[model samples]
Target: MTTNESIGDKFISHRMLSSFDINDELLQKLNTKGFTLKSEIQAVSDDTLRLMCNLSDEQLNTINELIRKSHKTIINHLTVSHIRKLSGNRIHTSLPSLDIALGGGLEVSKVTQICGEGGVGKTQICMQLCITVQIPEQFGGLSSHALYIDTENNLRPERLQSMAAFCLESYPELKQRYCAESMVSNVHLFSCNTNSRDLFELIMSRIEHFLDHHQEVRLVIIDSIANLFRYDYKGNEFQREYEISQMGHKIKSIAHRKRVAFLISNQVTYIPVEGKDTPALGKLWQTYCSTSFLIKRYGEYRKTYTLKSVNIETDRHFFFQITKNGIKEVLPDEVVDAIINNNKL
Candidate 1:
């Protein structure tokens, strides 16, 4: 049997399967079943494989061993420092205090969740990041494109245009390399009007192709991932959670493999036990995020607290307001004064 010597750490293709002594008929069957990539095959369960492809026990064992070997070859053993050095770069938020609190800015190759109630500026922050990611590297930016997956029909082009204009105006020198029009254009927006199933399919099937063609896209923003799941899966909690886990796994895989950042916005649900609102989708979904921020509206200013994070201290909070330009950080004194004024009124 020929070995898959040339398939070192890359996606398992039909040609590579030939090296495993998989016959042409079996290869065609796998293709028809959509088990094209190693990740796709690995994601499938043994039961599903048996039902879908009619693979016997021995054949299943062989395929599983082949995948394990391929995965082993893909794993890199490195020191802690080496791994940190290899991590993706950050994308600044354009706010000094917020960036400092984030230990730099939004990190690539990780999922960051922004959770908040309606009109708490979750989309505003996402829109700001879309523009900020386009800023030149000299200005502490990723200098790349951003993919905005709008599921709630909340993305406003006028808002993006205004934010981009202000971002450019803040740094006149950036005009040499960037303009408001170009920055706005770099943000690729997709409206997923269908149900949660459609969203899942979009992420699993279309996203990889989109990213392939737009290699410059370093950030992928799914504004309000909770929206898709809100109306769908009304009572089937188990199925809803299962689909969420699968979608999140695919998202994390793409983020790490492509070296891109993923920012997913989540809705807040009133937790009866806590007697307050919490990020929706339950704990299962929360485990997938590397960092999470909970935003609350207080008078004219909005407060964002670090609900959970791997790199930053929890309970750390900051205040910001939404202006025509975009999200601007509000100082502590300003927050206090605003509260006092609102009390007087």
Candidate 2:
């Protein structure tokens, strides 16, 4: 009689029209089974069909209100397949050269978690990406704007200027767009203490402000997620875990909602194990990241990092390194590939 009354697997069918064929037989079955339609079906505008199908009225109304209030949060992400399609799209960054290492570019609508020990160029890679995405496509970078939320004091105007100048050496016409001060200006930077509730508030405020003005925001980078948990969380163990898990889901939602590439840098610490080396954040953190990259010191100076897991292969681990300028491709050589492919490493 009511929405919740038909609450078994039959009720689930009302949510998605795509789940049912439009045949007379299926329609007759649906009618006979009392699996008719959700109340919201009548109000389902073309744009909101996916939203309606994927969420209950409660979830849809809550997220719909969020979109109405904020521009970046307004986009919809109902299905895992839809989310993956969004993440697979192109991303323009300030670092054109570095795009080569990212298999085209950093994921546009996915959360890319870059984890590394201290002094391993994680910040630098992020900065380079900021620079690379803003350069024109001709130079191997997508010319687009970026947002950098700095929980750490890693952002420097002078450094961004140098990278922009390097980008201009080849693309002289890019001077107007990549002007050191101007380009840096395009990069919206927000500094907030790690543990403060105001940090999350500040982030939300920026998104709301941008949405208010319908600002075009395509890329978002959070310098370090660990710092946020370390400082802001009261660490009640259970509560902290729940909060972190919720935050991870929210971050992923924002990336999809905004249709913007989200890259978050993470700090790594030694995980004690009796035998082999262990990852810092381990399995829990890995679950939140659509793409997880690990940066390790390979040669004396040739620090290599690799895509440990991506959507394609959640467990595929590859390796590469950093150079004086940016990320370098060090594909597994013949001998090394043989050893690895042969299950040696």
Candidate 3:
């Protein structure tokens, strides 16, 4: 039997059931019972296996032991050196203060979420990272490609072109190795205008395949994962949370195994109890990300506060602004000077 290996050391499809010592007849029965993925088999109850697949007690125990062993093979056992090597490998946001607040920058092999209300530059930051990730490694970038899954259709190629041009101008040396056209082309965009289930399927089924072909892609941006589920699961909060959890787990797994950074943008919802807005999708959704930031807009400037993080201080914030060039840090001195001048007027 032919087996398909997925990210990490796990078998993805039911074709790998043979690895568990299952005969062809039983494998066919499992497939006919709608257990097509290795995960599905692991999730099934022993009673279900007996009643549905006609597996004896002995067979069940053997399959369970094999599944446990299969799982153990993929469990990462990191050494001090491995941890140290991973610590330094991060994708910079190009804004020094923001990078500092982020403990270097958007961390690779982790899921980082940015939540904000409308016009707070969530998508802008995402677009900026898409370009920044492509910057050459010599310039302190990952020198990698980006995959943008646009849920709100907010990604504008013209804006990316302008940002890429500005990046080239900032690093004139980059002009020799990269052009604005090439930089823009490296950012692959996919529009998912459907509901949350479609988005989930895209991540579960197609994303790995796409990443397999585009090995250079080290960053995946999902601009506004909140939009799709906000209204779709109305009055069905449990289902909404369940779907979000599944997607988050898959994304986190992919990020870890592929050594890619996932920058997810989310919307804010008004919490009447707190008398303020907080990241949408509830507290359950927040646990999935390794780090999360909340961006707030104030006129032309924006402040991003760390809601949850591993390396950075909680509630730590830095100011920034969106210009024709892209995201630029609003230094403390600049903010103070502007306040002083406004007071005098």
TM-score list, all predictions: 0.76, 0.63, 0.75
lDDT of each: 0.77, 0.56, 0.77
Better of 1 and 2 by lDDT: 1
Any idea how many clashes model 2 has? 18
Mind sharing the TM-score for model 2?
A: 0.63
Clashing pairs in 3: none
lDDT, candidate 1, 1-345, per-residue tens: 112332223222211243455567666666555453444555558887766677788777777787666555444432344334544699888667667655578888777899999888999999999998888777777889999999989899888999988988889988888778888899999999778998989888888899999999999999888988988999898789778867776786677778899999999999888798889988767756767889998877888888875445688888889998999997888888768757522
TM-score order of candidates, top first: 1, 3, 2
lDDT digits (tens) for residues 1-345 of candidate 3: 111122222212212354565667766776555443454555546896778777778777776776667656533442334333546468889778667755688888777899999778999999999899988777767999999999998999999999999999999988988998888999998899988888879987889899999999999999888898899998998788767766765786677668899999999999889897799988767756767889887667787888876455688888888999999997867766666656421
Task: Please list the residue runs of candidate 2 whose C-alpha ends up more than 4 Å from where it truly belongs after superposition.
Answer: 1-88, 92-103, 194-196, 203-205, 211-214, 231-235, 274-282, 299-308, 311-345
The reply for model 1, stretches above 4 Å from the true place, is: 1-86, 341-345
lDDT of 2 at 173: 82
Highest TM-score, which number? 1
On a 0 to 100 scale, what is the lDDT of residue 308 in model 2? Answer: 44
The runs of at least 3 residues in candidate 3 whose Cα sits more than 4 Å from the true structure, single-residue gaps closed, are 1-84, 339-345
